[model samples]
Target: MSTFGKHYRVTTYGESHGRSVGCIVDGCPPGLQLAEQDIQPQMTRRRPGQSALTTPRNEKDKVEIQSGTEFGVTLGSPIALRVLNEDQRPKDYGGGGENIDMFPRPSHADWTYLEKYGVKSSSGGGRSSARETIGRVAAGAIAEKYLKDAYGVEIVAYTNSVGPIELFPSTKEHPSPSTNPAFLDFLNKVTREEVDSFLPVRCPDEKVSQSMSDLIGEFRDREDSIGGTVTCVIRNCPAGLGEPCFDKLEATLGLAMMSLPATKGFEIGSGFGGTRIPGSTHNDAWIKTPAIAPGETKPNVKQPKLTTKTNHSGGIQGGISNGAHIYFNVAFKPPATIGQAQQTTGYDGTEGVLAAKGRHDPCVIPRAVPIVESMAAITVMDALMAQLSREAARDRLQQAGMTNPAMMTATGNGHA
Candidate 1:
């Protein structure tokens, strides 16, 4: 059920607190460079110890390419990759005993997980932990490279909100947030302690970040937590990557976002904003202009011609990419784990009080930016591959001189 994609599906298995977690990507074309190093960068980005506002777990999260490659290039087989649970916590809370069933942490999915599976891991949050995302990020990194090399696709994401620290739409609307000098300086220079010291309102929004911090400080003085959203951008997507009827580009993107932990909502392009517009008001008009040199163009040649007076389509339409910039927003809920003590139950399954004794984030949204981008890259790459594979099939048919109507097309239908 973890499978994603019609042709190039990636199924991930294992638990966060399990002995290991891994992913198997079926349908990868052979001969691409596949190595542990290729997947490590993305894993490192998702690693917990990167900042101060995150968990204290100092896991290297090193990856091992177990199959589908020989001497680095893929063997045209399923790619299996994994990371060991090297920093697993002991099952004891030191309160006389570790009654994991009874020592449930507040805001965590422990109760729900137990209800569904009847058992859970005592180490971390078990399967509900963020650690499960490593497999996804790893697979995504590979997909990202393939898409980039094959179709010039680029994927990126930025922190849009951290509790009250939200990004207000620029009156001038620059190309992106991370591109601004002040914003980029803040992100690259501000330490976790600096960011964590603020209230829920001020992480990225100066005013809100400040005000939220004051309120959260009062709450922190009392012990509390918060939530927010992240914005992802995908560019240079090729046209016709996704199919119609089903597997629409936006549909697949939404599925990938929903699959992540703590994601409560999602929106692509003008998402809910289109409701306020009439057809004329919301429609993105097309206007062609003389092509300007886009990137490293030859001195004498202009860039390729493109059109789109507006981006209301979010770069996709009719379930397929229109070869435009694709962007989306993902909403994450407040971290379920909080420091406050609450009334719960014990392993004997009896009523009791619970105080969370482990280290956890008051917010997961800040760190989730990379995860959302990774999933987007993954979905885009898969769709791109499906398009390429179909093209390859058609080419083969052409070589065989199969001119029959059914054999030349990919609709799975034929009639001479």
Candidate 2:
């Protein structure tokens, strides 16, 4: 189904070259502080043609709140958002039959999508294109705000690799979770709190960031492309957010990761390498500490109620949040639409060589970070709501003749 979710469903429509692309959020608790600015920064992150490494297709990518809110707040109705395509060059991308269709790029879903659906759109990958992720990212931003304000959840993501230059490289043959700016390891480390800290986020390690940038700059001029991974982490997450069995946390996360374009691989916590480790090494043992402040209060913010010794589970345990650091990695392949020409079959079933037209990101991982974060937020917030609702429902059954449902207050708190 094009739509996803049980309690908090999101039905996204439109296409890359279509008039617009957006999402319709079904479940939202009204009266959360929200504004147009909340979703703007996220759109800017995935916006086409932003940096030298990305495609030059600039589409203002502005957000239009069509429903779900009156002034600037959510009205509990379905939150609908639409982003108009500002800069589009359908002529640049011709495919299938005669001069209309060029050679189909390999590793792209062009043909598979067509084979499965029997029909495709001109320009962009239609729904297959990264352009389709706008609606997801938009919905995610909203979810992020809700979680941040209500439960104080924070999620952050950044580039982790390119070709062989791995930022959060594994340690002792296993992926070690660390909050190193990777790109900015030299100056001050970027954290989840600083939303805009990574602006044009360069490598914290001057030498590394410059070297990577130089490599990208040179390749951009050469019309070549590259690929990498984006690392993301969440802090101060309460335990018991994910549903068991079918609706597991990792299951939901996989849905989001696999949905992005050019994403080759996905991993959470120790991932495959952990398979080699014994249970003693792979298992995460839990401990208790002072209460943590909400997601983004301050360093001195309330003592975190939840704490962990080792985050072997990457903050999630038993298909749910264990209150540790939640982290994962998303793999991306080099942009197939390079300036260099490659041999391929035309849409008409003829052999030909064609250089894929248009501008695109050689490395979508860095920018894809926000998209990933948005999804994580959306999923986590939905899961959180699910947990809270269940708790509320259980309490309702216990209070039978209770007249004041609002007076039910909090269902229950895990610990002091």
lDDT for position 54 in model 2: 71
lDDT of 1 by residue, 1-416 (tens): 66776676788877766788989988777878878887887787677765555667778989999899998898988889888977766553333364444666666777777778887665667667888888888788888777766666667665567665566443243333322345434432443244334423225456665554454444444456677777776766777778666788899999999989888998886666555545684576777734546784232212224556667677788888766668777888877766677787665667877766566666676567667867898788778777888888988888888757665455746644
What residue runs in model 1 are displaced by over 4 Å at the alpha carbon? Answer: 92-100, 103-107, 169-223, 289-306, 344-351, 393-416
Best by TM-score: 2
TM-score attained by model 2: 0.86
Q: Which digits, one per residue and each the tens of the lDDT, describe model 2 over residues 49-146? A: 67666777878889988888877778898998999987777766774332335556777777887788887776767788888889988999998888
Clashes per candidate, residues 3 or more apart or on different chains: 12, 23
TM-score of each: 0.80, 0.86
